[model samples]
Each structure stands twice: as structure tokens, then as C-alpha cells.
Target: MDRIRPWLILVGVFLLQFFLSELLAIRYYRPDFVVIFILYFGLFFGSYYGVIAGFIIGIFIDMTPLASYFGLSPMTYSITGYLAGHLQDKYIRWSPFAFHAAWLCIISFHFLVFTYVRYQLLFEVDIVQYLLRWFLTMTYTLIFLLILQFFFPIKRIQGA
Candidate 1:
């Protein structure tokens, strides 16, 4: 049972993503549940599980009609998972503040990538405006993270 916590979290997150987003979403600034779980498993469970969870979660997300591009999420999420998971395990075990900061960074990076891919603006686009949008979305993600953090703060892994 202990071995399957990540998978269970993935499933719960997926169900919440599908059913709760519409209700919880505040206009265009919906929190990314995928980011939440990805960050959790990545930071707590290590990169291997993080990548696997992100890949599977991305696939499930793509199956929904809401997904703009099927392939985008899988790529972006898998990478996010890996990067988050790569953080020093010792740092995570010692400090909640570190965990919070890392969580923000991972989620912010993900939105930047997600937005850039959606726009594909490259050199021609207005950089400042795009950045502002990214900042706002990151802020939105942070707010959700703060709320979730209260309920589920990371503890040291038993055997890791």
C-alpha cells in the first residue's frame, strides 16, 4: 500500500481536474491540479516517480475534450516532474519554506512553457505582455499551492 501512494494521488488529482475545475475556476485563472500533484510526487518521491506520474497524468488530461493540444501537456508535465524531483532531498526534509519556494518555481516554469507553446510567438511577439500573463498565472498557481500546502505539507520519506 505504501508503494502505491503516488498512483493513488495521481488518480485523485485526475478526478479533481476533470470534475472540480469548472466549479473552482475563477475566470481564466484556474489552478493547475496537475502541477500540484506533479510537484508533490516530484519533490517527495524523487524524479523517477515524478516523471512517471506526470506522463500518465498528461495522457489522461489529453483524453479530455478540453485539452488544446494532446501532445503539449505530456511533454511539459514530464519535464516539470523531472526538474522538481531533482531537488535536494535533504533540503526538502529540513525546510517547509524551501518546499514552498521550489513549488512556486516549478509551477511558474510550467506556465511559462505552456503559454509559450500555446502562443508560439517566438521573436515577433511582445515579450512584456507575454511575461505579465505568465506572471499572473504563476501567481494564481501559487495561491492554490498555498491553500493546498496547509493540508498537505511534506514529511521525510521513511526509506528514501
Candidate 2:
């Protein structure tokens, strides 16, 4: 039961990503909540598990009707997961600012790659528009991450 609990949580997170985002979306922007779970898994587990979970989640996401590109999610999420895993158990070693900066960079990179590839042609002529959209999406997702942290707090996770 203990082993299965985490997987169940992942699925629940995925479901929340779909359902909650629909209500919360502003125009075309929605938070990438699932990546939070991926990050959590990576931080708690190791790189190997992180990569595998990210790949599986991405694959499932890609299979959805909303996916513009088949493999884009898998690529981005797997990279995010891989990077996240490397930071595991390093919170104590790193300064608070550095630790936060690392995760922020990881999330930013994930959204940057995802938005660039998915909307490459659409925003080809308008580079400013591309940057704006990417920023908005990343910001939106980060807001949710912040809210979650306020409630659960990653510090507790690290101490555990």
C-alpha cells in the first residue's frame, strides 16, 4: 500500500491538472500542475525514478486530445524530472536562495522549451509575443507552486 500510494497521488495530480485548469484558465493560459508532482517525485526519489515518471506522465499527456505535438511533453517533462532529481537531498547543502533559484530555473526551462516548440510557427514572426506567452504561462504555473508551498512547504519535505 505504501508503494502504491505515490502512484495514486500522481494520477490524482494529473486529474487535478486537467479539471482544475479548465476552471482556472485565463484566456488560453493554464498552470502546468502535473510538473509539480513530477518535481516532487524527483526530489523524493532519484533520477532514475524521476525520468521514468516524467516520461510516463508526458506520454499520457501527449495521448490527450489537447496535445499539439506527440512527443513534446515527454521531452520537456523528462528533462525537468532529470534535473529535479539531481537536486534531491541537496537542500541542506545549498543556501536558501540557491535552492529556490535552481527549481525556478528548472521550471522555467521546461515551460520555455514546451511553449517554443508547441507554438514555434505561430509566433515565428513575433518574437515578443512568444516571450510574453511563455512568461505568462510560466508565471501562472509558478503562482500555483507558490500557493502549494505556502500550504505544504518543501522545507518539511526536505527535512523528512
Best by TM-score: 2
Task: RMSD for all candidates, in order, please.
Answer: 2.9, 1.2
Candidate 2's C-alpha runs over 4 A off are none
lDDT of each: 0.77, 0.87
Q: Model 2 reaches what TM-score against the true structure?
A: 0.95
Clashes of each: 0, 0
Query: Which 10 consecutive residues of model 2 have the lowest summed lDDT?
Result: 151-160
TM-score between model 1 and native: 0.83
TM-score of each: 0.83, 0.95
Q: Which pairs of residues have clashing backbones in candidate 1?
A: none
Q: What clash count does candidate 2 reach?
A: 0
Model 1 Cα lDDT, one tens digit per residue, 63-138: 9976888888888899888988887475636476775566567777899889888666741478887777777767
List runs of model 1 lying over 4 Å from the truth: 92-100, 121-126, 155-160
